[model samples]
Target: MSRIWDRMSLNFLSEDISVKSMKRSKQKTNVLLISAVCLSLSACGEFSYKRGASANDFQQEKKSCATQHKNDADVDACLANSGWIVVSADKPLFAEATTTDNKMPVQMTSDDKVIAEKPVDPLELIAVGSWWKTGAAPNALIADSEQCVTELGEAHQTRNNMSLVTRGLVGCMSAKGWFALKK
Candidate 1:
C-alpha cells in the first residue's frame, strides 16, 4: 500500500491560483478539452478509405476511422476544403463515407504504420468496474471488455474519475468494434 501510495501524488490539487491565472487556465483548459474530445470522437467514427483485405491489400476496414488531426483548426479547414457540410439546420450530417481518405490527419504507429483502430483511452474509463454493466454486455466479447478495463486500470491506477473511465471504456470497446447487445 505504501509503495502504491508512494507512486501517487496530488500536487495539482494543492496548487494556489490567482484570479488572472485561473481565468487563463479555464480558457486554455476549455479549448484543450474540447479539442481532445473532438479528436477522441473522431477516432471512433467511420471514415472513407481504400477498402480491401489481405493485410497488405488494405482497403476499407471498419477500424479505419479518421481520428488524427493536427489541430482543431486544421480539421475545420480540411472539412471546408472538402465541402463535406459542417452542419445544416435541416438534414442529418452523418452519412456512410465512400470517398477514400477523408483527408483528416492519420495517426501512425511508431513503425510509421497507419493505426487502423482507435486506441482505447483508459482515462475514459478510470473508475468503471467493468467495461459494461454485467448482464448488459455481450458474452462473446466480454474477454475484450475485461482486457479493456484492466488496461484502463493499469494505465491510470491513480486516476479515479468514473465518467472519464467509463468514456475510455466505451472508446476501447468502440475501437474494437464491440457492441453491447440488449438484454
Candidate 2:
C-alpha cells in the first residue's frame, strides 16, 4: 500500500512540474508575441515622404498628369519634380531631408565588375529622408557622398550651406534621368 502511495505521489509531482513548465512556456510565448507587435509598429510610420508642396498642388499635378498620355514613369517623374512626394498617408509632414554627402571616395576595387548590390529604391530612401546618387558604372549607385563632393567640384566645398550643394547634386542627377523614384 505504501509503495503504491509513493508512486502515486511521484506521478502527481511530475504532473505539477509539467503544468508549471507549460505555464512558463505560454508566458514566454505571450512576451515574444507582444515584443513582435511592438517592433512592427515602430517601423510603421517611418515610410512617409514629403516635398515642400501643398495637398491641393499634389492633387492638381496628379490630375494634370492623368490628362496627359505619358507613361506611369513619366507621370511619377512629373509629380516628383513638381514638389509632390509620395506619402504613406495624409499625415502631417515630419521633416524634410537636409542631409549632405561630403565624404570622398577613398579607394576603388581593382575589378571593374559591378558588385550587383540591390539598388536601394529612391522612393523608399526619400521616405526615410535619405538620398541616392548614380554611380560612375552602369547600374551602380554611388555608395556614399564622397563622389558628390568630387562631382560638385572644389568650388562647392566652400559654400556656407552644404545643403545647397546637395540640392545641386540632386538636380544634376535628376537632369540625367537618375532621379526616377520607382513607384
Best by lDDT: 2
Q: What is the lDDT of residue 75 in candidate 1?
A: 57
What lDDT would each prediction earn against the true structure?
Answer: 0.45, 0.52
Model 1, residue 130: displacement in angstroms?
13
Q: Write the per-residue lDDT of candidate 1 for residues 127-154, one digit (tens) a residue.
A: 2222334344456455765687687666
Q: Which ten residues in a row have the lowest lDDT in candidate 1?
A: 57-66
Off by over 4 Å in 1: 1-137, 154-165, 180-183
Per-residue error (Å), model 1, residue 154 = 4.6
TM accuracy, model 2? 0.28
- lDDT per residue for candidate 2 within 49-116, as digits (tens), equals 35565656666778898678468667766766665555443343333223455756657677756455
